[model samples]
Target: MKTIDLRSDTVTLPAQSMMDAIASAQLGDDVFQEDPTTNELESLAADTMGKEAALLVPSGTMANLVAVLSHCERGSEVILGDQAHTFMYEAGGISAFGGIHSRQLPNQRDGTLKLEDVESAIRQDNVHFPPTRLICLENTHNRCFGMPLTVGYTKSVAQLAGDNGIAVHVDGARIFNAAAALKINVKELTGSVDSVSFCLSKGLSAPVGSLVCGSAEFIAQARRNRKALGGGMRQAGIIAAAGIEALKTMVDRISDDHRNAKILADGIAEIDGLSIDIDTVKTNIVYFSLKRLEIAGEVLVNRMSELGIHFFELSPHTYRLVTHADVDENDMDEALKVFKKVMADL
Candidate 1:
């Protein structure tokens, strides 16, 4: 427990500078577009992602919901990976609140959706079928071992979406991690997409918030939708100040987290009872099955927590470890030692 917390990067604490910025931020009613700091954050985020405008929302989940509600009308369909955070973790807000239909495709080991499959899944112009209006993808996909969707892969799918007259949306909550890992520009990765939503809190270590960026016209529509969903907040500059700091300073250090993930993965791979495909780990999250250990995933999670090392399990047989800013090389070593001891007697 002394060293690592591998549950998720969402557990990361904000840096002192960010805290100071938040404490001293100038805030006004953001619902009235008067929070200057929030406005600046949105402008910078939109520019960074190569979009026309952006909106700040309370969380990445809300960002995704706002995007869906803005793009798809009730009874319309949106295509996405089955394992995507928007599909699997957002509690079907798009369906519950917007009445949107989701058309799901399997996520490959590399986190890219097959373009051919996406093309075939598009609904025809028929009265009975819900029209496919949007195609969604995740970069640095959280579920697929934090795998990064390559630029080529995204372009191919974006091409398919364009040819089929469907809009493309990227749930890029960990896009900076993706960019840093691939050593590519963020704008280049997102330029062809119709809209994108990324988190400020996860790897960036902002206390809370996410952003949705797209065409000016589209963003205007999303702003209205945000208010409709009660997502509009007043005087939100405190959070946006932290977001600004994260975008400025925390991005470059993500590779340290990526390197730590590899370190921990390599160590756990050497443990007798774990199975990990280190090759599939392109970013910060690591997933492996602990079947040989003959313990439930939750049991392992509890044991790890009690020992001051923490991790999350995907299912009964699958466990995951996510490295973040706080988990240094020393923490990785300590985690491995704990893993070996816990698995030795089993």
Candidate 2:
């Protein structure tokens, strides 16, 4: 039986074109800025995000960390949502390595921090306060039902940050998905921010890589931070080539993943024991919970896995499924059937 893994977009394997690019790519030491393929990818990434320059890093976490390290001095603070990936998932790298402090505000259901809340969270000029140096936002926010932060909201945050003499950075790991779902140019989502980091691995289907885009000065600083963090890769064009291929080919089809997610969410909503807000099926992520308290999420997950359909049990009752390049509409339909059978049997 074929296994349908809906755990995350990060699970996607690189396409054949990406593999071919990797095999044929020219290689040089990226640490010395001599890798032509890596340089080309960085240039392409910056142009795509409408930024003056870009730096390639190993992963999205490093991209965010490097961005923060470059933007603020030690002991400065950054404002972000409580549910943000950087706050919740990055394992305190910012504070551990950079001595940066974080002030987390409540996240709206649509994955935005209220402007008033953000403004209030900014520290007053006091000897005891950590100066707020940056504001962070997420595009296609993962924990909030994959909500895409709108362009207008981003501009508002950027404006507020600018007025307060603070910088803005976006943890845009799945930003391409956000652009596709919103039916807008990706640049519009990123134009106002001081820096934005996006992943080529997730949704883009590259083997590995993330790019941080910003002003040339910011990227030069970020590049130094990357080296300090031991992220400087030699002969990295072998992998960067795949990233170049992914950007060229994989962006436009993300809408198909969004469509599959809606279909999957609609199917889950129709199941007797499963519950979901079909309206929140915005991009490729579908989140649902069990209305039948008697059935544990792990039991359902394990049963579905036994049937070759795999997803995540986020909690005892809550579950998540992500549609990616590897999973298709037929896989979604089959998974729904298995989900129904498992719930009924349990």
Candidate 3:
């Protein structure tokens, strides 16, 4: 049987057109900002996000890292959802390398931080308290079954942040998914935040690259921070060329991933030993639980892997499945068969 990898959208391989673009891309030393293809990609990314400028980085981690460094000073604090990729997945770069403090609040199941909680979390001018300098949000929030945050909520948060003289940053790694789901332009989602970092490697099907978009002055500072973190790359346009195509062609098709994810979630809900909230299977991510069963998630994962189906076990009894450009209806059908067989044996 062929492998059906639903581990994450990041597992998607570059398309043939992307590979072609990579081979023929114009190249130059990016340190001096002479790479035409890189410059074009950055410009396009900035415009798409409605920002004054953008900086390309090696990964979503690096993109968020530089954005954090740009927005906050040493010993300052940033407010974020406890389940946010920045607060949960990132390796404490903000606190460790930048001396920034993180203040985390519980993320609602729908992937939003309570405004009242945010208001209460802001530090007053006590000399001993760290000032809150930034507020971070994730669109298509990863840990929340990839729920898409709305423009109204984002704007409200931005207004609150502005009232407190704080900047807002969005970890929009799968922002296009959010846009496609909401039937809104990408700018509607990004305009409220001060900066946004989005990935081309995820559902976009690019081999690698993420872009950080923000004000021209902010990007100028972020570019310096990228170098401080050893992120400067030479002849990077080869990879950037694929990113350019990803933006041009790969965005609209993400709707198909969303549909496939719902189909997988619906099928899982029908399985006797599994449970899922089909409504929460938004965008490309579907999270399900085997908690009702006697089997451990790891064992079930292993059993499914043997059948050429792969995904991540989020906890001892929970698993996460992500649909992407590569996986289709046929792949989901095959995966469902494997799931049923594995459950029967259990």
The residue-by-residue lDDT of candidate 2 on 69-155, one tens digit each, is 999999999999999999999989999999999999999999999999999999999989999999999999999999999999999
Candidate 1 lDDT, tens digit per residue, 51-152?
989999999999999999988999999999999999899999999999999999998877888878888899999999999999999998888888888888
lDDT of 3: 0.94
Q: Please report, as a residue range, the 10-residue window in candidate 1 with the lowest summed lDDT.
A: 291-300
**How displaced is residue 107 in candidate 2, in Å?**
0.6
State the TM-score for model 2: 0.99
Q: Which segments of model 1 are wrong by more than 4 Å? A: 1-3
Quote the positional error of residue 279 for candidate 1 in Å: 0.5
Cα lDDT of candidate 1 equals 0.90
Q: Tens digit of lDDT per residue, candidate 3, span 142-168?
A: 999899999999999999999989999
lDDT of each: 0.90, 0.94, 0.94
* Deviation of model 2 at 267, angstroms: 0.6
In candidate 1, the residue pairs with backbone N, CA or C atoms under 3 Å apart (3 or more residues apart, or in different chains) clash, namely 1-307, 1-308
